[model samples]
Target: MLTLNQIKNNPEELIKKLSVRNKDFSQLIHDAIKTDNKRKEIQSSLDATLEQSNKIAKSIGQLFKEGKQAEAGKAKSEAAELKEKAKELTAKLNDAKAELQTILFEIPNIPHPSVPAGKTDADNAEIRAGGTIPKLSKKVPHWELADTYDLIDFELGNKITGAGFPVYKGKGAKLQRALIAFFLDEADKAGFTEIMPPLVINEASGFGTGQLPDKEGQMYQVTEDKLFLIPTAEVPVTNLYRDVILKEDDFPIKMTAYSSCFRREAGSYGKDVRGLNRLHQFDKVEIVQIQHPDKSYETLDEMVAYVESLVQKLELPYRIVRLCGGDLGFTSALTYDFEVYSAGQDKWLEVSSVSNFETFQANRLKLRFKKVGEKQTQPAHTLNGSALALPRIVAALLENNYTEEGIKIPEVLQKFTNFDLIN
Candidate 1:
């Protein structure tokens, strides 16, 4: 929800930037401007009618005081007509504003200048890569390792829920807990205040994070309660500051939360949908930050560095890629995806995505920060990233660390997992 002022100031520039997403935004921009104009006109009519009606009421009082009952009655009738017109104008104004908002809702955020002009993930530019690709003699995939070592059960998950819901057993469940704890501890060490957000959120919470109306189909909804299962901890954690005004000193506000994320992931299939690769329910540790606009990009770099460090600590071979326009998330201006080399799958699996949504999500959330001596509050830049998501990270760890004895746990996670191997 871009502000009216933003749209009025060179909206064409915004539309042109969206060309990288490969869509035409001309008609949407036109409809928004037209609807705004109609709203302004209706608002003017309402104001004029209200003013005229007030004047007539004053005239009616004067006429009555001067012993002219017929004249007062005429004034009252005129006031009634004006009141009806004002009501009609008010309704029109509401309708017009609604129309304008509907159009705005359909428009995605404009990409940052650095966003590469591309159509898919394959077009994304690689930033940097780290660690050595393991040369394992056994080319066993993660699912096979899961079965051989009693880590996860897909059939039991299918029996209880359906496909795409995996049941982690024994050390498998312990590994999930360990990764969540490890990620949380790492984020907490990085000056992020930990928060435990709700698993179910209302429509406003979803929309505040740009998950509603657009991604409604990809979420599990509780129809009776009118709540949606949070697709990520990002939704609830970020929405906590919705409609809040922060002081200038709160520039680098950092918070982290670990939550069980749920996603419908409707219509996804193929070789990519196997095991922990894609899931209806998964665990994740999310980091969110609200920063001053002037320093947001710097903060984004710090977040990316922090996630990179975590991946390094896990001793996983990883690469960083700047998401191209088409592959970018709807609300993010820029995003860097961290993918771990899964030797088992013989491919890189995305374990984290760090993004900077400068003013785009803030406008929707009404989140603003007031300058020390300024009267007006300005929208602050919002940022978030998966310090690490468990499923794929778990997949990569198991696959890359496989040994004849058992799946060897990384030394960093051994303390958390309470054992070195998952046999």
Candidate 2:
């Protein structure tokens, strides 16, 4: 959520930036300004009335102590009228504040100045590409390769649960476990503390990470309990420091977590859902960092480099793209999506997304840090990224490393998988 001061200072500038994301902020921006003005007016009135009531009550008490009964009664009547006015003004102030909060919640984070003005993914700028796409002797999609090698059981997953939930079998299950461990290990080596958070979270946690309201249809909500299954480890990991105030020395707090993410994937259908491209449930290791406002962009670059290193170690063909304004997630000021080449599928599969949310999430979470010698608390910058998501990474591994003899495991993962190849 943006501060009222920020909105007041640059309402037009912010609105123009949000317009790049296709957001219609004219009414919301106007409403927010009006609500904030009304709230301030009501608050001023309530404070004045309360002050007058307190002063009159004190005078009434003094009059009674002096045995001045007639004067005390008049003073008491005046106090009662002031009290009633204060009460009415208080209610109006509360209503205005609530309305202002509603308007603020609807306003999205302003895009980073570097964010390109565009409407879709097609407008995203490619930062760099790495490794070479392997030339397959015989083209075979990951789904076909899974069936041939008895790696994953999509049909069994359907029979047990439903579509979009596939079961990893044999080497595939072991490979998935290996990948999770590998990702956590890689993240830990890069200074991220590993955490295991609850898969279910309350509404505050959801809204704190910007997953509620807008992405309501994308999550699996437990209606009876009013909790939601987390869509990414980012939601829970970032919320760990919610409502917390840290010292300036704690500027960069990094954390990583492995979780089975749940998404409703509503309205998604057809060929796009095939194989590991899209799924209802998928395993992923996410890295989150809380940094000082000044250091956030540098930390973002470091995070992107870290993810790129992991892909390089695995020898996967990948590229980084600076997401266009409209392609960026709602809460992220800037985003870089990493896509791995899938040989058989003849496409680049998105394996990770590293984003710098700046103060947008911290403002919502009330996550702040106090500088040395400073009494005031300021919102910290928050960032998160998928070190790697499993299904598609697994898809890339199988399709890219496919050989006539077997599927050659990436060298870095061989020790974890305990076998060099799945024949």
Candidate 3:
């Protein structure tokens, strides 16, 4: 969430930045300022009443001390009236604060200046691409390959847990484990501390990472416990620092985690969601960073490069694209998506997204850093990316690496899988 100072300093400028998201926020801005003013008024009135009441009580004590009972009684009555007024004002102030918070929640983060103005992914600008798209002798998608090799039991998964939940068997399960281990080892080599975060999170955790209220409809909720199944490791991993104040030296904090992510993926269908293209449950390795504001963009570049390296190691053909304003996530100021060419599907599949939130999430989390020798603290920038998500990466790998003999494993992962090919 944006801070009050940020909204007040240059509301017009903020409105212009937000307009790139293709919505009018002039009214929300106006309402925030207006509500803040009302809150201030109520606070002032409450303060004055409390002060006056204190003085009356002191004078009433003096009156009684002087043996003047009638004047003391009158003063007490006046004090009671002031107390009631203060109570009313206090309630109004609380209401105003709540109203202001609700308005702020409705407003999405302001897009970074580099964000291209566009309506969809089609409008996103390509940054760069790499690797060669393999010319397969047999262009078989992962699902068909899964059946041919008895690797994944889609029907068994459907019978047990419905569609979108796949049961990996034999080499398919080994491949999943190998990828997770390979990604984690690479992240560890990249100076990221590995953390095993909870698979479920509370409401505050969701809000801390800018997921709740905004994406609640797309999350699996445990209504009885008021907990939500984390849509990504990013949520619990990032929320670990909620309400924490770090020293300046804590800048460039990097952490990584491999978790089983769950998402409702509601209303998704068609060929796009087929097989391993999209899933309700999947494995992913997420990298999160909390960096000083001045160096966050640099860190974002590093993170993007790091993700690029992972796909490269997997021997997958990949491209990077800068998300346009309308396609950007609600909390991200700028984002870069990584897509791998799926030879079988004859299309590109998104395998990762690296983003810089630029204090948007920090403000909500109260995650701040204190400057050396300074009394004040300020919000730090938050960033996270999928070093690599398994399903699509698997989709691309299985499709692109298909051979007449067997599905060839990339050399980098062969050590983990303990074999070179899955036949």
Q: Judged by lDDT, which candidate is best?
A: 3
Give the poorly placed runs of model 1, Cα more than 4 Å off.
55-72
Which residues of candidate 3, in runs, are more than 4 Å off?
54-73
Please give the TM-score that candidate 2 achieves against the real structure: 0.96
lDDT against true structure, model 1: 0.92
Off by over 4 Å in 2: 58-72
Q: Higher-lDDT candidate among 1 and 3?
A: 3
Q: lDDT of each prediction vs. the true structure?
A: 0.92, 0.92, 0.93
lDDT of 3 at 11: 96
TM-score, per-candidate, Cα-based: 0.96, 0.96, 0.96
What is candidate 2's lDDT per residue for 142-216, written digit by digit as tens? 999999999999999999999999999999999999999999999999989999999999999998998876788
lDDT of 3 by residue, 260-337 (tens): 999999999999889998899999999999999999999999999999999898989999999998899888999999
Instruction: Report clash pairs, candidate 3.
Output: none
Candidate 1 TM-score over all chains jointly:
0.96
